[model samples]
Target: MNISHLENQTFNPSTFLLTGFLGLEYAHRWISLPFCFIYMTVILGNCTILHVIRTDSSLHEPMYYFLAMLALTDLGLCLTTLPTVLGIFWFDAREIPFSACFTQLFFIHSLSLVESSVLLSMAFDRFVAICNPLRYGSILTTQRIVTMALAFAFRSFSLIVPLPLLLRRFHYCRTNVLSHSYCLHLEIMKLACSDIIVNHIYGLTVVAFTVGIDSLLIFLSYVFILKTVLSIASREERLKAFNTCVSHICAVLLFYVPMIGLSLIHRFGERAPHIVHILMSYVYLLAPPLMNPVVYSIKTKQIRQRILKKLCAVKLIQT
Candidate 1:
């Protein structure tokens, strides 16, 4: 197995194999049924959210704007994950090109951070609406939302840009079998034959600065929001003020719980079953996008009413 001849040139493989759920090869097709359904639901649900938000003038506010951003990010996640996931489940097409693999990994990681950023923005939005109701409009104008969106996207890209390049410098000569259907930075990095201390450091740094800091900010924003809500004397007022935050709290939990679960499993579940890893990764990728729209639509009165109105209009037209 001496790749001595590769020393003259380089030893980068042309493709990396993506692994789906293991020991369930007999049920891969059955597994694909839920995945297909999840993909379709994500598309329909997020598209419905985007359409509802765009077409309704009454819904044009900072809250819905951030929700729209969330929808877009969810769609981005869906697109990035769908190809490799379905490829593995349905077609057994797991041999992703090195470049394509890196690109997929980048978007998967980047969009998660963007989603984190959006959630943080939404938290702040809640804090403003609850804690500073009078000046909310001035603080979170459309212009500022756009600016924040741009800044978040750029920050995610900048923080993640080094990953592929760092990975490129290493020569991967080990088994290219990856644990999940999609390319993950750590999973791929593990295949390299060289020292990966730097990669590990940089990866940890990115997670800390992006997801760590953002989640902390979101928690603090909610603390302030809770404090403000408590100051309101009337029980009715307290409930009403707290109600505005319910959808956001659900969204945050949806996005972060699976994420934190998967992270913990990766760090501490080394002796755990491989299927546990695959299942955790699946939840990490699929749950948030598939569930966010449902949560928001059910929780947010305006979005629910708008969706119902649109559905009724369609029904009337069809009739």
Candidate 2:
């Protein structure tokens, strides 16, 4: 409505929350090269993993299907931040427009919610496989996988669509410069001139429902898995069960730890090292995408060998 008025009222934050990294003065420049390499590798690696799982008939089980969904969510997460983040570092346009900032915040969190849901689905799949091996095929059917995926998509949309729309009702006159590298909802909310009682309440409620409830469900699934493993009464069977879950366990820890850390810092330890804050965001968000394929390949020997065989086939075709 009032374009110029919005432009003039905003203060461009010179330093962001993650300003204290590798070297604060030239952190953006210094981190760019390595960050780009890792980011590219993550994208390519995830794409390859997804492609292999989708194309190879033998790899189309529920576990790998869930993994493909994980890769898709990871790609969405990276796409949300990569353009703006890289542009900020490589070019001069470090400031984001208000509309764009809110868009980024919405997608980032939406994809995050979707990723969490996918993980929950994977846990359930594992539980069914380990606890009721006979019924695994019947339980995790094609129609069921499609339903789980749709549920994840629907839940993410239902949860996050309200957030950005609600945020639009608030007027951010305090300062437009977001502290973090990207426009995080909480970080940006701190800049609002209007009373943010609604925003904070909505945020906490969503967190409690999605992250809190999903985490509890995941815990219950694992508890059942552990109990089933223990009942086997053979050390070999116990180790095998533990081994099957190691990758998912690693992924869950990587995701939830930094998430909890970020929430804590955002809530109480706002004064924590800026680099710590920044790195934690990437570790929490970026690392999950990067590690998902590696963890799955390492733990699920079939996918690992399939990946290796695919690579070998490519090499032979080239040679």
Candidate 3:
């Protein structure tokens, strides 16, 4: 199958987006250290959370299972972009090979989509557990959870597979300097010499189908949750329900708010500062992973206690 007309293009941008304030040209030293720190924290924190979820027997429920999946996705996400991003910052290799760039775009986008779907599933699980307590087990059975997880994976891969292939269809005739650290779809689309009408339409369509749909469903789930809480006769039950969801709500906002902002900024804030855009991108991608563990530990007593016990055990072993 013939793909992407490899006409052998070269890019000659004096400065990449990471280099400084867009084309304004600023020092790389300032951003590099901070970016490195963020990348390390994201990787290590998510890995720790993943390990906790895996080894803790009490956390075998649907909630923690989904949380582990979230950590896994975030880990993949960091691996997808951060290493190349750091390389670009630390080293000066702005020229990404066409094939490798497209592949990076594929995994990053696929994992992001999967994260959104998984969040939606988590919201649905919460709704069932809080609103229909008796049916929670039957509704979210182990088999059903596995099926949902598989569906999330399949959907993400299916949506993103088309993007790289579509990008591969085009010839690299013009600028190869990706504006952002990684090879995002929008950045590549902008670089294409041919008519990008199909690319834009297809990209927007998928975004709407995946991100938009998932976000809306999450909103609706919270709506039902709120209604159920309001109608409950016992104030204790209502408070418990609300408390249980606080962490998930925080995580959802951390994930989607920046995403929505980034989309809006990319679409509408064209004249805005490039630094602003770059900062927003980092927050959108990194903030969720950073906040997730904190949210869980703060809101879920069991997780908090388990983490504390582990900390104390380490201290005792040291002593």
Candidate 4:
């Protein structure tokens, strides 16, 4: 627990073995089929969202711009986990170098916070648009958006930088086998032989203050948005303001529901089956990235129109 404890030597594994499901090894190849589809869809969907926002002049507003940031975070998560996730299934490649595993853990944690922050940002954008439509343009300018993006990115990066260093000091005397297909701070730290009280305390503090608090803020933002929408003089105005938030509400649910589920399972479901743990982890990581783009494209008329037009052109060329 002491920084001076760095002087103590400990056994560090050359690599850690990542695992799929506990008893599902026999079905890994079969399971790979759906996961392969999911990964492909996540990449294509998020990429399309980003491309449409970037090329289409109509999407230059703060809302779509924040959507692009969400897409980037999704892509970042996919890039971080894709290799080992697919590798574990198709090639049976479970071995990850210790340093590589730590790096993976870093990105996985950092991008998660970035995703949460992006959701809050989108909610705030909606709040401003609904409460003060006239001043929305003046408030959320391009410079301000860039500044917000950097501020969150810096926050996520700075908070996560200590994890790898802190973890390096821990001794793993037992099996370095991880519970899931990817390296996670929780799973990796489970194998530590030395006292991990400090790691646990620090990690929980980060989660509570960062992601947990941000989720609360997102909710409060929507509460204010709803109040503003309700006070509107016109029925059409209320509906219009409320409808604009449907996509963001869906995005928030997609990201947070499985996240909360995984957390709950870990906290109270200690006796839960091993596969339960693995399945929940997969859902938390894969579902949001895959679903967010789909939900947004379906709910946001501008995005949906662009995506549909692109698809029609592609279909016509193929025919």
The residue-by-residue lDDT of candidate 4 on 1-319, one tens digit each, is 2212211332237777777764667898999999999999999999999999998898899999999999999999998999999898888897888889999999999999999999999988998888888999999999999999999999999999899888898888776777788888877787888898888898999999899999999989988888887888999988878889998998899889998898788768879887788889999999999999999998999999999988898999999
Candidate 2 C-alpha RMSD relative to the actual structure: 4.4
RMSD of each predicted structure: 4.0, 4.4, 5.0, 5.3
| Candidate 1 structure lDDT | 0.89
| Per-residue lDDT value at 254 in model 2 | 74
Per-residue lDDT tens digits for candidate 3, residues 153-217, read: 99999988988888777765564555567777887777667788888999999999999999999
Per-residue lDDT of model 2, residues 89-123, tens digit only: 67635566667877888899999999889889989
Q: Pick the candidate with the highest TM-score.
A: 1
Query: Candidate 4 versus the native: TM-score?
Result: 0.94
If ranked by lDDT, best first, what sequence of candidates would result?
A: 1, 4, 2, 3
Query: Stretches of candidate 4 above 4 Å error?
Result: 1-12, 316-319
Q: Considering TM-score, which of the candidate structures 3 and 4 is the better prediction for this target? A: 4
Tell me the whole-model lDDT of each prediction, alpha carbons only.
0.89, 0.80, 0.79, 0.88
lDDT of 1 by residue, 1-319 (tens): 1223223233337777777766676688999998899999999999999999999999899999999999999999999989889887888786788899999989999999999999999999999999999999999999999999999999999899999989888887766677788988988888899999999999999999999999999999988988888889999999988888998898899899999988888778888888788888988888888989999999899999999999999999999
Report how far residue 126 has shifted in candidate 3, in Å. Answer: 0.7
The residue pairs in collision within model 2 are 17-179
Each model's TM-score, in the order given? 0.95, 0.92, 0.91, 0.94
What's the C-alpha lDDT at position 255 in model 2?
Answer: 80
Candidate 3 lDDT at 130 equals 82
Clashing pairs in 1: none
